[model samples]
Target: MEADHEVAPPNLADIDVSAWRELETAATSPQSGFRFLNLCSVDSEARPQARMVVLRRADGPSRVLEFHTDSRSPKWRELSTKPHVTVLGFSTQTRLQFRLQGTVELHAPGSDQANAAWDKLSPWTRTTYTGGPPGDECGFEMIDEAVLPKPQDDAKGKPHFGLLIFRARTLDWFQLRRQGNRRALLTYDETGALAACRWVNP
Candidate 1:
């Protein structure tokens, strides 16, 4: 049985365009509890790769989403080869699942956009990219995590840090409810301009 305080069933007849607004709002605000998404890309061997990434920025007007990563990460190579990617995310609070598809643009540390994002990172977060290149081979001996080199300033790890900007072309939004489900696809043009928003079978 559902809890007494659970949200009431949704009405499929009504389509809420605010879903996109809510998603952007949630992604930009960490307190909203929807700041994480699964970023999927295709590797050199044509295999799909997926990983959880924090949502750094979401611009509805431009249909762009930004996230941070280490320059040496495997996903970076994959994305460099195949710029197209799919992002899957869910908000447990709203019971909404979003499938986003987009092309990626990587910004190096010195770029204004990358520098702005780098300046906002806390010391600890910056330290994450300070270690040896991601995916480097380790010998059979155990290593001390405490002795890892730490970056003293943005300049130290800036070379290894990267910012990934995703230009979204489409979004498939699905809402789950006990009574019924609702789904819609919001498509954008090559320039990231909204082209159409239409409802489809869940």
Candidate 2:
């Protein structure tokens, strides 16, 4: 029999389910701690580059994730050169951290994936891609304009808008707690099937 005041510890299966559920929630919820991921990639100079990217999509069954990016950004070029990346996110509320290693697939302009992602963007988000190239100097006066998501304006941004699809090869999940910490590693096969799951020391 269990003690009345004792709490139940989650098993491996429960932890796996919870991790995926949190990821799915993070993709849709703005207030989610995991909504913003720190994406790291290697640059041409063999140095690591890190940037914060929004979590646009999460599919647990397929072990896939997606994020939108400007096609002209340096990260885009770097990722194009080396498709491998590390994505990290954490939730203070839950004390859970997710670190994912994966290869990214870029969907260029007019591609089916990019088109679908672009259509889902709100008018305000669509305006982000209308500006000058990312990381470019403001050579001219930066005037403020209420850029509405007009068809033409949206068209200008379309060429710079692209989608990055991440297929996870492994996931490292960790939970921090006062009493004790827990960690687990989940690996996926080439076909996106979960190949193995095991708990590790935190």
Candidate 3:
């Protein structure tokens, strides 16, 4: 006996979203384009700290982006207090850049989303957060480590494992080409509605 499979028709609502997804994919391709964003976050004193982080996930239709970090890290605390953040992604291969400004929400340790993400993490990845707090000063040059407990079988589930969700409000896209530099600013209003999109010379 032969099995049959059916393909569903594409949804028209996904057209614009698909375009943005393509852009994200091209920007995050491992071989040519891996590191994209230089995420910037502010401390309690309003001091800015920028770091390079991999773009783990993106949902253009929902206008959401995901990035992971140590829960005990200072940046996590900063994000908890101040939810606003800025992410800058540059593709050296295409000389294209994307700047994202958004508000972030930290998922609780054992929340459904957090649990799902933890399940997907490899044992090596889980070991990093096995220690106490991330940024706590141990006052030691280096210390030998022990075997980390598995997430599922361990008595204490991944303590400091968490996920950050950024709800993007505006996206600034720039393209650099040999012929003419181009840039575009796509802004969303405070009401969560896409406001105006315009092109400018880079």
Per-model RMSD to reference? 3.8, 3.0, 9.3
Candidate 2's error at 24, in angstroms?
A: 1.0
Give me the runs in candidate 2 sitting further than 4 Å from their true place. 1-8, 139-152
In terms of lDDT, the poorest run of 10 residues in model 1 is 9-18
Ranking by lDDT: 2, 1, 3
Distance from true location, Cα of 179 in model 2, Å: 2.1
Candidate No. with top TM-score: 2
- Candidate that beats the other on TM-score, 1 or 3, i.e. the better one: 1
Worst 10 residues of 2 by lDDT: 140-149
Against the true structure, what is each candidate's TM-score?
0.83, 0.90, 0.76
What C-alpha lDDT, on a 0 to 100 scale, does residue 167 get in candidate 2? 93
Give one digit per residue, the lDDT tens place, for model 2 in 45-72: 9999999999988988888889999999
User: Cα deviation of 133 in candidate 3 (Å)?
Assistant: 2.8
Local accuracy of candidate 1 as per-residue lDDT tens digits, 73-133: 8999999889999988888888889899989999866889888999898887887776678
Winner by lDDT between candidate 2 and candidate 1? 2
